[model samples]
Target chain A: MSTIDPTGHPNVHQTAAELATGDKTDTLLQTDGLRKDFGGFTATDEVDFSVDAGELRCLIGPNGAGKSTLLKLVIGTYAPSAGSIYYNGRDITDLAPHRRVRRGISMKFQVPSVYGELTVRENARLPIQRFADGEERRRRVDDAIAAAGLTGYEDVAASVLSHGQQQQLEIGMAAALEPDLLLLDEPVAGLDVAEREAIAERIVRLNEEEDIAFVVIEHDTDFVASIADEVTVLHNGDVFREGPVEEIKADPDVQRIYLGDEQ
Target chain B: MVANTTDGAGSADAGGPMDALRRRIEGPNTVGNSRGFWIGFTVAVASLVAYPLAVGSYQASRFSLFLVYAFLGLSLSVVWGYAGVLSFGQVVFFGIAGYTFGIVSVNFATPLGITAAFLLGVMGSALVAAVLGYFMFYGGVRDVYVTIITLVSTLVLHTFMAQTAGDEWTIGTAALGGFNGMPTIPTLALGVGGAAFTFDSVTFYYFVLALLIATYLGLRAVVNSDYGRVMVAVREDEDRTRMFGYDVKRTKLAVFTLGGALAGLSGVLYASWGNYVSPQVFELAFASLPVIWVSVGGRKTLLGAVVATVGIEFVRNSLGGEWAFIAVGSLLLVFVLGLPGGIVPWIHRAYVDARGDATASNPPEAETVEVSD
Candidate 1:
C-alpha cells in the first residue's frame, strides 16, 4: 500500500521511525522530514538527508531541484520551515551562522565571496584569526596560502585574482578555520579541465589528509564520480535516488531525471 | 595598536644600497611614522608651534578656532570612515556638550561645576549614541534608514532648540537664549575649587593643539587594533563578517559611541574658545560642514580629515565673507566628482605607482606569477 505522510519529508513516517529508533549513530549531519515554505509556495518540501562522519558526499539535481536550499538549511542561512537538523548526534536546528562556525562548520557560496579590497594574506588572516593568534596565526595563514598555491600573490589584492584562483583562495581561507565539515556550492563550476582538476585534487587531498567531511553541490558527473563516495539525487525537493556513484550513474531513473533523458 | 605591525628588518637587513632603498619604500605606515608622514607631521607641528610667535594674537586665536573644527572632521572619520555608520546628527553631540558646559559653568560658577559639566557632557553623548545605535542596529534598520533617521533627528533638534529663546526656558540659573545663543559662557581653566587660572589666548591655542594631537594618536591606535581590523571588515562586508564569527552590531555600537564622545569633547573645546553656546550649533549647515571636510580630505585616513579641515578653514578665514563657503562648496563638488577615494588614497596610489616603476628596473627575488585561469 502507498501512503502519504503530512510532514512533507517524502517518507516522514519511515525516516522518523528510523531516527527515533537510533538507526543512524555515525551521522554527522542529519535532516529529517525537512520542509521549507515561502509564503504560499514550497521551496524545499519533505526532504530527508544526512552526511556520515569523514564521508565525501555529492548532492546533484536539475535546476530548481532545491539542492542549494537544502545546503542553506544545513548551514542555518535559511531556517527550516519544519523538521529537525541534528549535528554530531545533537539537535542544532536553530543556531545562527556564527554559532555554526564556532561549532566547526564552514561553507563557500557559488560565487567566490573573498574580500576583494583586502590582500590575499589579509583574506587568510581574517578567518585564521578566530582560531589562532600570535605566531600560530601567521603559520596557519602561510600554510593555507601555500595549500591554495597562492604563496607569491599574498600581498596582491584579491580582486586581481582570476576566477579559479579566487575560488581556491576561498577554499584555502575556509580550510584555515580547520572546520570539521565543509559545504561548497559549485566549487569548480565553469572552470576549464586543468583548473577543474587542480581544485578536485585539492579537495580530495584535504578530505583524506584532514579527515574533513564535505557535501559538495555539483553538476559535473565525472568530477562527482572522482571525489564523491555516495551521491544523492533530488527531484522536485524529494530524494529521487541515492547510492554509490557508479550505481547512481547506472540508475535509469536518475538518468531520466538528471542526465537529461526524454520520457 | 600598531605596535605589532613591524619587525626590526632595517637593522637585521642593513646591507646593499638596493636593499636599503627597498626597505625605506616599505617602512611601517603606523600612526605618523612613515618617512613621508613623519616629515609632514614634523613640519605641521613646527609651523603650528611657531604660529603664535610669528603671527598676532588675533590671528592665533582665529587659527585656534580652526583647530576646534579639525576635531569635528576627525570625529566623522571615526564614525563614518572606519565603522561605516553615516551619522548626519554628529552636531547633536556637539550641541549637547556646548549647552551642557555653558549651563553648568554659568549656574554653579565653580571649578567643580565646570568639571562636572565636561564629564557629564561627554558621557551623556556616549550614552545617547549607545542607546540609539543599539536600537537602530538591533532593530535591523536598513543603512539608508539609519542615515535618514540621523538626519531627521538633527533637523528636529535644530527646530526644538530654536524655539527655546523665551526667558521661561531657563535651566537652573542659565537661560536657553534660543537662536540668539547664550553669550558670556565661562572659559575653561585649571586648578581646584575657585582658585583656577584662566588661560590666555596663546595658552589656550597650545592647550587645544595638545588635545588635538592626543586625540589623533589615540584614534590611530584604535583603528590599528584587532577591533579596528574587524571594523573595516564590517564596512567591507557585513554579512560575510557575521558568518566569520564577529559580533557586527556590538562593533558598530562601540565605534558609534566613541565617535559621539569625541564630538562631545570637541564641543566643550569650542564652547570654551568662543565663550558662548548656541542653538545654532545644531543647525543643518553646521551639521553638513564636517561631512564636506572629511570627504574632501579622504575619509579613511584621519590625517586627511584634519588637514582638510585646517586647510579649508584657513582659506575660509583669508577669503572672508561667503567666498569661503562658495570655495569650499566648489571644492567639495570637485572632490566628489573627480576623486571618489579622496585625496589621501589618491596620493597613496601615486606613491605606489612611482615605487612600482622604480622596482620594475630590478626584479624582486620573488615575483607574483599569475596562475592559469
Candidate 2:
C-alpha cells in the first residue's frame, strides 16, 4: 500500500482491496454500515465509505440523496442511528464534534461559515491555535492563508470579503487545523466560473502539496471531473456506484441515474 | 486531478454585525487612537478619586453602593454581551455573596473571616453557575430558552429567599431576616479590638471604586485574550466553533461561572457598603435590572456597562425608586428600538465615522504597492 502510486493510475484489482479493508496507513477515513434515521425516515442507510490518504474524492448525488447527511455522520455532527465510523482505523462513531476535530478531521459547511466577526488571520488563527502556540501558531496561520491565496487579505474582516473570498477564508480556516481528512460541502456552490475554477485549483494544489485527503460534495460534474481522482455517487441514502471519474462517467447506471440519461 | 486557476486581486475589508460588536467588546482599534477614550478615562479616574472627598459621608456611602452595583452590570455584560448567554438570574449571584458575607462577617468578626467570606462568596457563586450552566449548555438548551431558564430560576430563587425570613432561617448567628432584611450588618474592617480600621468612613467609597476599576480592566483583558476571542466566536456560532475543535459547552460554562463570581464579588461589596442583606436583592423586578444596565451601557463592553450602571443608578437615586423604574423602562425601550448596539458602540461608531471623514478628505499616501517584481 505504501508503494502504491498516487498518480491516478488505473489498478482495478488493487482499488477493490482498498475499499473492503482499507490499508491502515493509506486510509484516512472509513465508515462501515453507517446508518442514520430521523423518525421513520432514513436519512442515511447502510453504507460503507472510505477515503484513502492524499486522494481527492468527490461525492455526487441528486437532491435528498443523503450527501449532506453522510457528511454530517462522518464529521460527528449527528451520531449514527446504527453502524460505526473509523478515522485512521480507530472507531470514532461516538466521538463528539470537537473530539473528532482534535483527531485530525475538519470540515467546511455548505455555507461560507468563516468567523465573520474576525479578521481573515484571526479566523484561521482560531483553529491553528488549538495545537500550536506563539510563533508556530503565527506561521501556520500565514501558511494557511497563503495556501488559500488569501495572503493579502489576512488583516481584513471576513464579512467584507466577496462571496468567493469568504469561501476561501473558510477553507483557509480548515487548512490551518492541518487535518488528515477535510470534508467540503458544496465548496463552490455559488460562484462565477472564474471563482469556481480558482477554488477548484486551490483544493487540488492543497491535496497534492499537503498530502491531505478531501471528500468534496459538488453538483457540477465538470468541476468534479477537473479535480476528483475518484467519484462516489450516493442515491437514496446508499452508495449507488463508486469508481474512478472516467469509469463512473462511462458507466450506464451513473448516466441513467445521475448524468441525466443523455450520455 | 488536473486544475489551473488564479485568484483575482481584490480589497480585503469586513465589518459584519458581529465584527462591529467584536470591535466594541475588544476595543482593538478604538482605545489606543481615539482621543475621546483618553479624555473619558481621565475624567472618570479624577471623579472617582475626588467624589467621596467632596460629598457628605452619608451621600458618599450611596456612591459606593453604586460602584458595587456596577459589578453586577459588568458580570451581565460578560455573560450576555460577550458570551451571548442571556441570564435573568444574575441577581442570584449577588444575593449569594450578600448572604455569605453577612453570615461570615457577623459570626467570625475577624480580618481573616472577612477575607475568607469574599473568597467563599465568589467560589460559591461560581459553583452554582457552573452547575446551572452545565445543565443549560450541555443539555442543549440555547438562545432564548437559556434566557427563559435563567429568568425562571431568578423568580424561583427570589421566592425561596423570601420564605427564608421565618424564625428557623438563621444560619449560624446571622438571621435570615425574611423580607424585612438583615440590618446593622457589621461594616468591613481590619484589626481585632482597639486598632481595627473600619471602612465605614469615606475610605470605603474609594475602596469600592478601586475594586470596580480593577475588575473593569481585568475583564477587558480577559475578553481580549485568545480564550476570550474563542468565547466570542462560540457566541457567534456554536457549531462552527465546535467544528474548529473547541468544547463549546465547556467554554460557555467557564464564562458563565466567571460572570457569576464577578457578580458574587459585587454582592459582597454591596452588603459591606450598605451594612444590609435582604431578599430584596433577589426580587424579580430588581433581578431584571442588571440586563437593562448592560443593554443600555453596551452589552459587550465592560466600561460601557460600568458607566451605564452608575449613570442609571444615579438617575434612579435622584428621581426616587418608583419613578426611576419608569424612567429605566422608557430608556430601555428607546435603547432597544433605536440603539441596539448600546451607547459605547454608538460612540465608537461616531468616532470611526468622524475619523473616516477626516481621512477621506485627505487621503493617506498610497499604502499598497502597484506590483511586486
Model 2 residue runs over 4 Å out of place are A1-24, A255-263, B1-36, B190-196, B357-373
Cα-based lDDT for every prediction: 0.78, 0.80
Winning model by DockQ = 2
Q: For model 1, how big is the iRMS in angstroms?
A: 5.2
Candidate 1 deviant stretches above 4 angstroms: A1-23, A32-35, A38-40, A89-91, A256-263, B1-33, B194-200, B320-322, B357-373
DockQ category of candidate 2? acceptable
lDDT of 2 by residue, A45-82 (tens): 99899898888999998888899999999988888999
The Cα error of candidate 1 at residue A41, in Å, is: 3.8
Candidate 1's TM-score reads: 0.86
Candidate 1: lDDT of A50?
Answer: 83
Per-residue alpha-carbon lDDT of candidate 2 for residues B245-308, written as tens digits (9 for 90 to 100) = 9999999999999989999988888888878888888887898789899889889677779989
Candidate 2 local lDDT, residue B151: 81
Candidate 1 DockQ score?
A: 0.27
lDDT of 2 at B23: 39
